[model samples]
Target chain A: MSEPIAGAPNGEPLSSDRPPAPSPEEAIRPDGRWLAQVEAASGVKAGACYGCKKCSNGCPLSFAMDLHPYQVVRYLQLGQMDKLEGSSTVWICASCQTCLTRCPNQVDLPRLMDWLKEELVRRGQAAPEEKVRLFHQLFLKGVAKRGRVFEGELMAGYMLKTGGAFGPEAIKNARLGLTMLKKGRMKLLPERNKDRRWLKALFREPKGGSHA
Target chain B: MPEVSYYPGCSLEATAKDYAESVEGVCEALDIELRELPDWNCCGASAAHSLDHRAALNLGARNLALAAQGPSPLVVPCALCYNRLASARHELLEGDDLVIDEIKALGGGYAGVEVVELNDYLSSPEVTALAKQRATDLDLSGLKAVCYYGCQGQRPPAVTGKADYENPQGLDRLLGALGVTVMDWPFKTDCCGASHSVPRPDLVFTLVAKLYKRALDQGANCIVTGCQMCQANLDMYQEEIAKQMGKQVYLPVLYFTEVMGLALGIDETPKWLKRHLVSPKGLLEKAQLPRQTWERL
Candidate 1:
C-alpha cells in the first residue's frame, strides 16, 4: 500500500490549505472528469444524485458509516476520491441495495460502493473496515476453489484471518457452530463442481477487458 | 402441471437442510414437480457481487445456461441465490453491450429462461388453489406468525422484480391461504444482517434483536421467513438475543415451506420442524395445528 500523503485519508490530497478541513458539504468542488469516471466505472449517474438523502435515511448501517449514502454520492459528485477512500462508508456497505430501491434518481449506491471497493483494493490501500473486506475476499476465494461454500471451511478461514481463532470470540462462535452441527445444519464436507476450470476462469480478468 | 427447475444453492444442502426438506414436502403436496438443476454451483451471492462483479455474474449466468437447457421456470429457494441468478440475467439484458458479449461467451447465452423465486411460484393462483385443497385436512389458523422477507427477496427491482418490493405479500398470502394468521409488522422486508451472522455477530445480534422485539410486540407466536440466511440468523440467535434482552424470549423462526408443509399434512412434519435451533413443536402444539402422525414425541 502507498504511504499516506499529508492531509489525505488514503492518498490524494485536498486542493485547499489543510488545517481543520471543511465539512463535506462546504468542500464540494465540481470535477467533471471525476463525475464521468465514477459514472463510467459504476454505471451509475453520479450527476443525478441531486442531494436527496433518501438513500441515507433508508440505509440500515448509515449510523455506523463515516459518510452516509448521500455523502458518498456528494464525494462522487465532486470527484473526491480521497474523501471516499478515507471514509468507511464504502468499505462498510453491506450491499443490501436498500439505497438502490429508494433512490428517486435511480442511483445505484450499492453498485457505486462495489466500484469504490474495487478501486481501494486496486490501489492496495488499507480498507477503512478490515473484517468486511477480508470476509468478501475469503467468500469469493472459497467459491472459486470449491463450487460451493462450506460454512465450516468459510468460518475457519475467516476466524484464522481475523484473529478469531484461539480468541474468545472463536469459542463463542464454536458454541454456535456446535449447536448448528447437532441440528445437522452444517456439513463437514464441501461439495465441489465436476469441472471447476470454467468457474475458476471467471474470476480472472479477461485480456484488455474492464471488469466494471 | 409444469415441472419447475429447482436450484437449492449451497446453503440448502447444509445449513438449510430443513428448508430443503420442507420445501420438497410442500412442493409435492402442491403437485409442483421440481427438477433439481443438474450439478448447480454457488450463486456467489452476499459476497461475490461485492468483490468481483464479473465473476459473480458469470457464476449466476452459468446456472442460467444450465437451466436453459431444460424446460422449466428456474425455481430458486434461497433468497440470495434468487437474487444472484435473477440479477445476472437482468444485468446481461440491461448492462453494457461489451460486458454482455463477454458474459454470453463465458457462461453461454441463455434465452427465455425465467428465474422465479420459490415464494412466488408457490403463491401463484393455481398453486394456491392446490395448496388450499391439500391443506383442507390440516389446521393452522390458530397459529399467529410474522413473515420476514429480508433483503434479496425484494430489493433492486431489476433483479427480484417482485411486484411489491416495499411490502411483499406473496409469503403473506401463501401462509394466509394455509390458515396462518400473518401479522401486520413493519419490519417485514428489512435486512437481517445476512452474512454478518458471521464475522460480526455483534451487528447481527442488534439487527436481529429489533426483529425479535417487533415480532413479540405484535404478539406473534413464531416468525416465518423465505430466505435460508434470514431463517438461520433469527432461529439460531434467539438464545443470544434473549441474553441481550435480559429476558427469556422464545420465537421459532421457520421457513415458509415448513409452515406450508405442516398445513399440507406432509408425511414428515417432525423431520423439518424438529431441526430448528428454536423448536416450534411447543408453538405448534399450543396452536392446535394438526399433528396427525408424529404425536408420539
Candidate 2:
C-alpha cells in the first residue's frame, strides 16, 4: 500500500557519526538518535524502543548477556553510551533477531547493538579480546578479498586464530572436532586464490579497513 | 542458451539424489543449462568448518575453483553449500596474505571465479520473468509455508546483499504468485544444527524445538527451505525432538526448489523427497496436482 514509509523509523541510513560520546545534558536520550538511524537502515524497526522486555523472553542467550536486548535499546534511546559502549551485549547476540522480531515496538535490537559495538570498537571504548575480534575481522576480511567470503582460507585462518587465541578452549572442543572429521566435516587446509585485487576493486567501501 | 554450473554438494550426491534428478528436470524446463563441475569434492559444509576452519574454507574453495573452469556462474541449491562456497570465496579474497600463500601452496590458485547461492543466482529479475513464463497452472493459493532460510542465507548482511538476511521472503513472493500463502514464522533462520545432529542429538533437540514450535505456532503445514542441511536437520530431527520433548510436532520440510518444481507441475515425487525422514508429500496436495496420473510418473 502506501510505500511502507521509505526509510526506517527515523529515516535512511545515517550518514553521520555517534553523538559526540554523550554529553551529560545531551545524554538523556543520546544513544537513541544514532540507534534510530541504524534501526532505520535495517528497515525492520519503525520507531524507537520504549523499554519493553518481550525480546528478553525469547532470547536464547539472555542469561549469559550483560545487557539485555531491551536494556541495549533503552541505553541507546536514553543516550547512555557509556553503558552501551563497553557492553558485552553485541558479541552475546547470536544476531538471531528473535527479540527484534518479537518486539512490540518494532525496535531492531541487533542493529542497534551492532551499531553501538562498532562505535565502541572504533572509539577504543570497548576492548574486545583480539582473539574474539578475530571472528569478526575474518568475516569482513574474506569479503574484501573475493567480493564474497572465501570459506576455505577463512576456515583455516579462523582455526589458527582460535587455537592461537584461546589455547585450551580451542582444544577443549576437540570432541566436536572429532565428530566433524568423522563425518567428513573437517578440512585440513584452505585452497589458494588469485583474485584479491579484483575483489577489493568490487567493494563499495572496505568496511573493516582503516578510518574514513 | 542459459547455463548454470551445478554444485550438488554432498547431500544431493549421497542422501538426496532425487533432488539432483528433479533439479535437472526443472533446469530443462527453465531452459537453464546445468553443468556439473568436474571433480568437485565435499564443500566442507558444517562438518569441515566446525572441526577446522581452514580445511573447510579450502574445501569450499576447491569447489569454487572447479566451477571457475566453466563459463556459467556456479549455482548451489543447498544453503549450506552456498554459504560455504561464498564464505570460502570471501576468505580466499580477504584472508591473511601469509596464510593464503600457504593455501596456494596446495589447492593451486583458487582462480576466484564467482560462486553464487542458487537462490541468489536464480533471484535475478530475469529468472523471475522466466519462471513466470514457464510455470504450469498449479494455482497453489492455499499452501501455507514457513520459508526457512536457515543460518547461511542471511547474516552478516554485509555479504548476502539487501535480502533481509534474516526473514528473506523473496522465494515466498514467488510462491505467492503461484498461489501459496506464506506464514510469518520467527524460525526462518534458526539453527537446525546441520550435520551436528548425528554426533550431538541433544543440541539438535533444542534447535529443532525452536524450529518446529515456531512453524507450528505459525500454523504452517510445511517448512520450505533452500538448504539440504536445513531439510535433513528438520525432517530427521523432528521425530527426535518429539521423542525428547515428548510432544508430537511434525512439520514436513522440502527444498524450496522441490516445491517450485511441484507447483510447476513436474511432480513425480522426486526420489530424494522420499529420502527425507519427514514426509513432504503434502506438497503434492498443496500443489493441487492431479494425484492419480502424476503419481505414476
Residue lDDT tens for model 2, A99-173: 655677666665555555555655655444343345555655554444333443554577675563266745534
Top candidate (TM-score): 1
lDDT of candidate 1 at residue B210, scale 0 to 100: 86
After superposition, which runs of candidate 1 have C-alpha atoms over 4 Å from their true positions?
A1-30, A205-212, B95-107, B290-297
- Candidate 2, residue B191: CA error in Å? 1.4
Which docking band does candidate 2 fall into?
incorrect
CA-based DockQ, model 1 = 0.46
lDDT of 2 by residue, B22-71 (tens): 67776777888888877566565443343234445656665666676686
Residue B95 lDDT (model 1) = 46
In candidate 1 the C-alpha lDDT for residue B55 amounts to 75
Candidate 2 yields a Cα-based lDDT of 0.60
Instruction: Give the per-residue lDDT digits (tens) of candidate 1, residues A1-212.
Output: 35456867756745555489788877767776888887887788878988879999998877678899898898788877888887888866777789999899998889888888877877777887778878888888888787788778988998887778886977987888898888888899889888677754665565654332
Predicted chain A of candidate 1: TM-score: 0.81
Cα displacement (angstroms), candidate 1, residue A87, comes to: 1.9
Candidate 2 lands at a TM-score of 0.58
Instruction: Put down candidate 1 lDDT per residue, B152-197, tens digits, no spaces.
Output: 8788886777778988888889888888998989998888888876
